[model samples]
Target chain A: MTRLGRSAGRRPSSGFGDAPEVVVEHAGFFSHLVTRSTGRALRMEIEARLARARGAAVAVLDLTHVVMIDYACADEIVAKIVERTGQGGARRVLALLRGVSEHTREPIQRALARRGLAACAEGTGGRGMLLGEIRDRENRAWEEVTRLGRAGTARTTEAVARRLGTGDRQATEALETLTARGLIFGDGSHYVSVAVMARADTSTASADDE
Target chain B: MSRVLSVSPELDHQAFEALVAELPDATRSGVSILFDASAVTWVSPYGLIGLLALGREVEQRTGKRPMLEPPRNREVSGYMERMEFWPAAQNVFQLPGKQARRHGDSGALIEITSIRSNEDVHAVVKKVGEGARRILQGRLGYSKASVIHFSIMLSEVCQNIVEHAGSLGWACAQTYRWQRRLGREVAVLAVMDVGIGFEQSLGARNASTGSAAALEAAVLRGESRFKDRGRGHGLQAIRRQVLEWHGSLRIRSGAAMVGDIAEWERRLAAGAGGEYAPDRVSVKTGLPPFPGAQVMIVLPAAEESITPGPEAA
Candidate 1:
């Protein structure tokens, strides 16, 4: 059984034909997760209802309450929508994200852009919030890697481990793999600044064929 | 005067040592060695770095850097780029020819055009790997790891072609050298094909995602255009390897281009460092236009090896 609920306000719409439309309010990380799981359920329910109603069906993900968003949840929601609508072609999936801040809205916008899905965050009604602090951690790691180069190897590994909340061995292994491939070079001592290695060489012998 | 030195598998090391020994006593005031990589079938970072170290030594002694000829093998070039030694080498040597032109200098070029199926992918990769090992043994007098990661990258790319490139098509790889500059050498490797463009094969994910997204996804390590259950880490792995190793990765798909690591770096340097931006180019497919993907990997000269820190050793 799916828990379907609606925000306060608005009279019962007639077109949906008794398939309860769930309205999502308050977008945070947890809210986003609930919305995604709920969205999946709603999509199935709407499809079933449409089959019974003998009419066209649609799923509207109203992010009017979403205050923030991050990459993982944004990817999950957008990917699900794109997959269902693009592949299934059974229901019209519309995203009504509103009232989100620019900073919070960017990742979703980017994902949408990549999928060729048109969406905009407008005013206070459209804001979506990112949960779990994943984006915050990723940005910090990128910044650290870009600043310290190989000298920051340990720190970068530690930061990534902390961000992913995974074991340190995995992170260290990743770093070692990169080093063996000649992507990041260091003597395994003090960290060299990223400025030197960051200006990597782009031209060589590989550009001949196409 | 440029010279071509061919040695048997057994004499490879002896030949390299002889060359290095001869360097110190050469009558020429400034000696710049230009490796005729066209004839050399394979190479690796360890082998390459050994030769590069010798070149560095020569430069230190005579104030002239030895030059490395571009690799005639695309697989070898890919590996070089991943090591990030290609561009740094460019600072010391002349640039190789652009696109598909044949080498004009007096060196040999090994053309690898025998790739046809998934099985062939393995064979060619192994052949290239062995060839690189042989080259290192003959030219640099050193042997490091036998396993080359580029072989893995090549296998994945070739597998993609075998499984998807639509019908039967062939692949070619070549390497060569330019000239010595500022006491260093520049080498290059170029790979081309006549198959379905990346967009046609990967763009099927979502008609809306288009070819560009497919290309971007291909280079993103974990993203795969295929719905198959296997790890779709081929191109993504290649991209990360290239970036970390100090090389460049360039991809072309029928009028749409994505995955230019150099351009990415420039954007990063310019402080426009969010996600990658798309740039459109006019491309032609083979059915009517020239359709297919051309991947060029450029690597600079290898940096001098730093003495391992006490903590690392």
Candidate 2:
């Protein structure tokens, strides 16, 4: 269910109704030696505009034009943009990432990983992956789902729920999210990450049988 | 009688300019030189290479063979012995220095070693990037972005030594203060190989026929020895980077030599005095050619710079 949280009394912080989307055009070979000051300026613009617009917005950082991104510059630009723009928490702007190539995605992923933040990342070529945190409560759910890999288990929602002590609904959400991010595959009734699937093949054919 | 050119203990790139500065007039004066290495402290790979250039300059101008007075000190001479410096100098001047085995990396100019494979190229690139980064950032004032480009440039040049030369090669880099030309600091990266020459390599790929056309096409047009897509941008990228930094590129292989003297090569076709120099200028020389390709790239101090922040280092 897509429920819209009301922001009548104050500015909507996060995971809410239609927010303003800002496009940040990336330029050049985006290098560690080349930190874009404009990224910081864009975050400030969001902060200042949100204070005036008096509501929440989602800032989609468009890096389609950026040729290359090294690790250090990626951290300098993206992490600060995410943390300073009120996307660090709720009641401010949220940061979403789009137009990442395999070349650019690595450094961006490393930067987000270092900050313990997550943003929706997608390349212009249609591959999307999740990194850092998801705004919803199912943010850390994938850890338990991937942990099932060590036991060499191919699990259904019920099995994962039983193993992780989460409700069936939570397990289903976790499995669905993991599948969407291409981290796991769903074979009709069972969910299996690659290692778990490999182990399942040797241990029991039950995954295929079911 | 040959004039004696005293060799400093430190015959590094830092001293190369001042050493080379008097050479043009000295060689023009048409005197064979006696390169005295008696009181030398150390000689980097680039320094040895510089010594080779000095020999070539003297021979190319006066046709008189210069001789070397090897360092009297046992340690300095041994260092040269380990570097195979004498033989390398002998290659240019036809002097008397023993030909020994080219040894491993000695931390002088990204190591004085032969590149055998892609792994060697990567190792050299990593070492050059790490060791030279401080010089580029602090001294030459290139942004980190430019430094990455330089890394790619170095890798491409070194990789060429393996892929195209078809023979073992040597690569080295050093930062020097250019008091004469630009009067600022510059970083010079030189890669040389004693293998099948450019004309042969390009001809083998069915790209061009002769040494002149092949040398011109390979360096100027960035044409590769393979007819594959997404390949052969090393020299071209280096050329563009040199343009951006207002640097220079000089390349000599086989019987054909092309030099762009706008720091040595420039962005536009213009070489020096606003005269249009083609991407490559083939000079026919009678001097016996080196067995492989030899390229020297000079990146001048950046015209524009930012005050590096505390975290910049």
Candidate 3:
């Protein structure tokens, strides 16, 4: 991993140091696998850049150029670094790994699920949240859908259907399916998905236990 | 006191059966069994992983941590260390270790690894992907995309252990020339776990589909134990990937074993169409009860693909 580019200034809102973003470009592929050493070296390079900036900003692991990412490398680089946040750590920088393709995304997702860690990934329309972090939350579905904004405020069956290019019935079914998974909120006729709604009434309680 | 089960040089399914046959007699003697690999010079994925599955069974029957007498042959000992077989074994059965031995890329074998967590799956997937790149893509001359499917397929297949197997499992892979059938090369991956088998695990949720039907349901229908439809895509991905490459897949669990050995001649004749024909794949039943499950995917060496993705024209 090499320092290909970087963002200079901080976001106007948060106001934590400059909050400069470090962009790492991977060269070559052990057939595009980020192995243990590769991951460690990459993490060190990113950490070195992050040390210069204060406060927590999203660390975008730009993989626009790298073709593939495998599991071991994903764990060593992404998962391990992402784990180092909360309660008196050196620094807390949100890790937003930009995927080049499914080859990268799939392994990272599986790794996150395995470690019981939730990672905020960049999604369509610039909306993203910690995928596994909110798994236990009952209303996370509605919140995620709301965050989409593209799906609209109500997230209606017809609207979802139109967006997904499927039938209204299929859209309704998909909503119901998400509701069943406790990822979304559906009231048979309508749906409401928002950040607060997705949070569990008792944050400590397991939604699935009910 | 322990009854030692001396492993053969070629430690595959045949070797496993021989070890199992000796189990009853060993148990009757009221002593623990220790696997002796001192003589084993050659090991395949099936043999390496089958050792763990067998170890789990032995522990349950006798209530003891499985033991192994280190290989006397330097090559065997070196191979075990390089593959991280010793370290993974020590973790699973709770044994002591010698120093680390680094595995090489020259061989067709991917080192045996324990899959206790998703993290383990990740490490194995990376290694398997490297194997696919080197063996399938580089040596066999398969297209870049075809090799990627092998990685994805490996990921899905190995993930089953951590997701479904209540206890630990192991995975290994190897590539070699398939002289008799395809007249080219074939990559063999063998993964096994000793836990509540498919029938006990997902059979009730799937209407007691039994062991055989459950295996088929998982692979064919992508059935998950959870009602969440998003869940069970592992086997389905494996099925589709294997089919796309005209590979052979065998899943044996509980009382039955099912295999879809894609007919090579028909595949060549069909050419681009790649239609689904029932005769091309076969599923068998009443496979003499085995604990847990074993999945084997054999991808034969083929020329570069005309179509990039897994789908047909």
- Candidate 2 segments whose C-alpha is farther than 4 A from its true place: A1-210, B1-47, B50-111, B263-288, B304-313
Candidate 1 lDDT tens digits, A80-130: 443333222212222333344443454455445444343322345422222
Instruction: Choose the strongest candidate by TM-score.
Output: 3
Ranking by lDDT: 3, 2, 1
DockQ of each: 0.01, 0.02, 0.06
What lDDT tens digits, residue by residue, belong to model 2 across residues A11-117?
Answer: 22121223332222222222222222333444444445444434433345556666554343455556655554433222344444656765567556656665655
Ordered list by TM-score, greatest first? 3, 2, 1
Clashes of 1: 74
Candidate 1 differs from the real structure by a C-alpha RMSD in angstroms, to one decimal, of: 24.2
- TM-score winner, 2 or 3: 3
Candidate 3 overall lDDT versus native: 0.60
lDDT of all predictions: 0.41, 0.55, 0.60
Tens-digit lDDT string for candidate 3 (A1-210): 344334433433211122232122222223355344466677777667655555433456655555556554666666665554321221344455544354566667755565555555544334444454333222243343554422322345555666666676766666665544333333333343322221223123212111
The sequence of per-residue lDDT tens digits that candidate 3 reaches over residues B116-165 is 77667667666666566777777767788766667666666666776677
lDDT of 2 at A97: 60
Query: What DockQ number belongs to candidate 3?
Result: 0.06
Q: TM-score for all predictions? A: 0.34, 0.45, 0.57
